[model samples]
Target: MRGLRKYLTPFAPDQSGAVSVLYELGGIIVICDAGGCTGNVCGFDEPRWFERKSAVFSAGLRDMDAILGRDDRLVAKLVDAADKIDANFAAIVGTPVPAVIGTDYQALKRMCEKKTDLPILAIDTDGMELYDKGEEKSVSCIIYCICKGKI
Candidate 1:
């Protein structure tokens, strides 16, 4: 798997461009992930985009938490982080590790919404799934869920 820095670092050079585009469009921006080494990297490019929109949050799932079904910790962390950033909504993106362990994302979603009164989107992007496959699945799910009024 690629290192988080590898994916996130390059975006620093392009931050201005990405932020400008997202700002013009307007909306919350979030990158969900388990607390994997690489998952954070996937999000490196997002902070700038998020900062521009003035809304962003991350929910980091720990390894032990994933195996033990301790999604509450993740939920708490997410809530705290969301509050710190004052995010309007949050996005939940999965990493390879959580997918393998079968984390109960649905429950986490419910908890986050109940606690924060903010919209939560749970995206399944298990690492074992091919890159494109995961991306497509996550995007499709988000679209379908939105159109169905599930989000």
Candidate 2:
């Protein structure tokens, strides 16, 4: 605990912030968690789920999926959802699960981009970070992918 503080940050997790920024952006926002993160977003963080219509979903990652680093399966699921939904882009918002597993969001973005026509915004947001950080991340992703044509 050399550099660790006793108190946790006074901000919400990045997943909540990521979803907030993209909630009305007309794209599919996927929470890369088993279910807890997504539940937090809908049940607590974002109460607008009842009023606003966003294509937010959970990757529904299972135990072995994370253990085996099943990036392909996630990419496939994203692409399939993009095909069915009329979305301009797709966002993969990371949580503690992917963070612990060392998920490479850039590679996932590339994989999703190759398979789907929609632009993919992969925000590698671990649940430990503040909500504003995730908001900044999602905005940065837009700038990097759209402004710089990384898409």
| TM-score between model 1 and native | 0.60
Residue-by-residue lDDT tens digits, candidate 1, 1-151: 6765532322222212222232332224343344333334335533443444444333455556667878777777777776776454565666556666776667867888898866776665554433445445555655765797755
Candidate 2 per-residue C-alpha lDDT over 33-144 given as tens digits, one digit per residue, 9 for 90 to 100: 9998898888788889988768889999999999999889898888889889999889999999889889999899889999998888989899888889889998898888
TM-score for each model? 0.60, 0.90
Alpha carbon lDDT of each predicted model: 0.53, 0.88
Clashing pairs in 1: 4-41, 32-93, 96-127
Best by TM-score: 2
Give model 1 RMSD, 1 decimal: 7.3
RMSD of each: 7.3, 2.6
